[model samples]
Target: MATNNLINDMIITKRALPLFRDTNGFIKNIDRSYDSYFGKSGAKIGASVNVRLPNDPVVGDGPVVSPQSIAERSVPLTVAYRKHVSLGFDTQERTLNVDDFSGRYIEPSVNNLTGSVADIAMTLALGAANMVRNVDGNGNTIAPTSETWLQAKAKLTKQHAPTADRFAVLDPDTDASTVSGLMGLFNPSAQIGQQTKTGAMEAPLLGVREWINDQTCLVTTTGSYDSAATATGSVTTLSNAGNAIPGQISSTAYPQNSVIATSALNGGINAGDVITIAGVNQVNRVTKRSYGTPMQFVVTQAVASGATSIVVSPALVGPAADGSQNQYQTVDALPVADAKITLVGKQGETIRRNLLFNKKAMTLVTVDLMEVNKGVVDCGMANLDGISMRTLTYYNGTDDTLGTRLDVLFGIGVLRPEWLCIVPDIVDAG
Candidate 1:
């Protein structure tokens, strides 16, 4: 029972759970999340921010005698919800296999949790899709070079983004492909090499601190956005979109994927599936729907599948018009009708992403779900930078099923939407 005590004791889990640090892929080294904890004590579990900060006043010469008072600005703090994704497992004491349990149960659950966090953080960088002005005017591919670094740093500087603690999180595949050529440094040996364990490059270079974050930085194909021929050019509401469900490709044209309203998957695209059309030279993997823009795919709001048409991530980039010529074809495989499509792959590839940010852009916060301190970090009940793993044996009254759960609670908040820049579709050689 001594070992049992170790697993059951909350204190032991709090202190000793750290021994499993090396096992975690992304959570351990997320600098921004740890650094951006807004010190709000006893805040609610769900994320909601108050934005009463006043707009910058016009600068002028000081009054000779009396000073003019600007009108009192009273504004409401906009509150946004934090997405919570958890993974856990159950074990029966009598037949519990501790040796392999870690491999089967704990690792999978923890890995999912870590991966979810990575995905969440990545959405921040996805902001590039909608930037008022981006590094590339078209928001498409760019060959890597030191000038690329200068441009990225310049964007932040233009935004008046703080010069300190700034970072450029690179898409490993894109960076490896483009950065080297731009810097004129050829190290073929390191082409597409394995990303760092923390998913970041080791050194800071150029004018700003930089990181190669393969785990969280997303590289997705384009999705079909507008279909003028359809009754509705685009699906605006989530419900009409069928809660963003999986949509099958209706047909595929050579060198290009489906043409919206023409031959798109009638219906069968999963929300999280990373799919691509087989025949097209420029492959597209749909991520999510564009909330406002008809043709641009940006928003991540879940819309279940419906019969009309499917929406995708990185907003599938297609011809200007339905009958337009397919200009994206390559010598390799061209998309064919009903070609096989794979969901988002784990490896880095065509899509590109770079998140340059400071504290104002986004804030990450972790709270103890089980304890009732609300959102306060009081006792060691919930460790901030570390994870809290606990075991609970329970049964549901309905089916008498017994299970155990070990989960985590965390959130990445895009507080100041304008403060960050998500540069995607760059060509780099990391």
Candidate 2:
């Protein structure tokens, strides 16, 4: 009858943390160094931490101290997501031991929360500039291979992504397909032996730890605009007279992080669709050397039919010969006026987004939640390996029920989009 007779909040909190850590396959590999900043109280949604960007070195003459002004660059990692799972328990359920209670309640709560976080994090994948299509040049989707993974790695290497802590996450079907394709290639070694025993790819292969993540994104259709479009104008300069120029210039109102085109986008551009403009090649992050591949842009927002403009992510920043461009330069050159626009796949096609990246490419930050000390409930919060979760158990006298809720506050950020690549496969139908 008393609240004290309910399950131990502290024990539930502790058990939930391990379940959360072990359940996620994708978010576990992302950078979580920013978690330390949000461990305190009053850390609310929209709270942000600046991730410092590396500065370019200046070649100076003979210690003359000709000081070139340095501009500090940073990307904001903001806490903008809040999610929770609440469950009601009967009297008998509350008296169970910690393990029994955890397996019955806490494990499922943590697993649901984990999948929610991974889904939210997948939105950041749209910002990736490097895409290794499972489809061939003739534009038909195929199964992924070891060479597919290697292509993703090569893309990251060209962008100068850190070689260590790399990962590749595939959908279950793609994982099975890739593993089956790789089963006959390697000698009978421990890595292969482990995979063979598990009937799946569990070991690191081709410089990346492979994972099967059901949360991997799948898009059923892209933009339906079939014919090629032409850029109405050009992104002439990064800025004019120290003032950052808006994407919309003059009467040609190009949306921010978007392109203004001359053709009527019939079905319009859809979110998650990949597109490229002729002559806009990708460049290395450090050297700014052209990789000779057209820079890929993923649509981040939907545009209406007959619209002349479309939105995209990783805002176009063309490279410069001098170090005059912004530190976040993304492409070798801007689209010239009338540059041809080409979509990657057919108008309506299924795409499974399998991701590969360096750990620094993405970041996930979790923060401790504020307690409800004034409420008539038992509350406990726990932090483990940069993750914080809280459990609240309360009694409802009307229905005579015990309710427990688990809550998590977190944020996801795309740090180095160049370091993130998508190895997409077709989501085959039955």
Candidate 3:
């Protein structure tokens, strides 16, 4: 029969089997695998190493050393376990326990194993492209129409009324060209009447001319004048040289130069002929003025007693040459107006980020697992054992029966086999 002391020792030793080199060695192997798999630059993917034991204890009232005393005094060696495991830069570090393999780790690893590096790289590239396509500098998604120029003139005209002069002609000759260019920037098919349909109908009629000088003069359609008092009935007698017969006529009525009079005083004047007394100015000069200010219109309908004599409250007339022409013509006391472009929000940037993150995460996880699987198989275990040892095998029993058994043994510590199986060649089903 087995001694009670031996049975107790056996139990203790059996319990301590998990704490042996096998358990700690497995962790160390995992750490090395993780580092080699994820740590391209020699940084370990496993958590920081933490020793689970305190310093050596001091002995008091100790006797001479004996085999039993030594055995009793011997301390079990502590295990240095990795406390945290880093998945990647974007994710939070996960904590690990003794004999604890996370399903989360397995999923990431399987994803890495089955995934393609080239495909992953392509996905990341596409994602980055998507993100760049959607955003502006202010963290706002750029709208399709955000690049358009605001129609300032149209806005002002709509708020106010259509007037001959709303915008101050910066350069009257080039103003149309400037507006056309601005419109073309927003729309390639932009035209004067097409894009800006809100402006005044008579706006194009406004023109600029140089001001000669301020002077009053008469304008007559008739070429020459004649006197009614002349007796010779000759055209030459009525034609006056300078200072010939200044203001001798009693009435303003005069005669045309050549009149075929049937009876002199009672005869009618010929059509297209005019009469003017001597010493009256016979020339009229046209006046031109500067129209430098902006003007808005107010429409008002007028009522009249007769059909032809209606008095419109806001009468429409030919624009006068000067501001002093009429009180209604001058647009001096008017309020200033302005316009702006409104931008709407879009989801271009968000879509881009999501696409990029998903593609990259999938790729990285796949590559990591593939490398890990390769390493595990290289360590020389059973073919089915290699599949069972995979992290994903625990969560998903997709592998064969042998794989399931190996997975169970590793997870539950039921079979503490020391042998590690090498991985066989993996054939792509695709």
What Cα-based lDDT does every candidate model obtain?
Answer: 0.39, 0.72, 0.19
Against the true structure, candidate 2 reaches a TM-score of: 0.87
Q: Sort by TM-score, best first.
A: 2, 1, 3
In candidate 2, what are the lDDT values of residues 170-289, reduced to their tens digit?
A: 787787888889989988898888887887777567888656556545545556777567777544322111101121111111112544454566667666677888888887666666
Listed per candidate, the RMSD to the true structure in angstroms reads 13.9, 5.4, 45.2
TM-score of 1: 0.50
lDDT of 3 by residue, 257-328 (tens): 121111122222211111221211111111212233222111011111121111111112122345332222
Best by lDDT: 2
> Residue 285 lDDT in model 1?
18
- TM-score of the candidate numbered 3? 0.13
Judged by lDDT against the true structure, how good is candidate 3? Answer: 0.19
The lDDT ranking, best first, is: 2, 1, 3
Q: Which is the better candidate, 1 or 3, if ranked by TM-score?
A: 1
Could you tell me every candidate's TM-score relative to the true structure? 0.50, 0.87, 0.13
Worst 10 residues of 1 by lDDT: 246-255
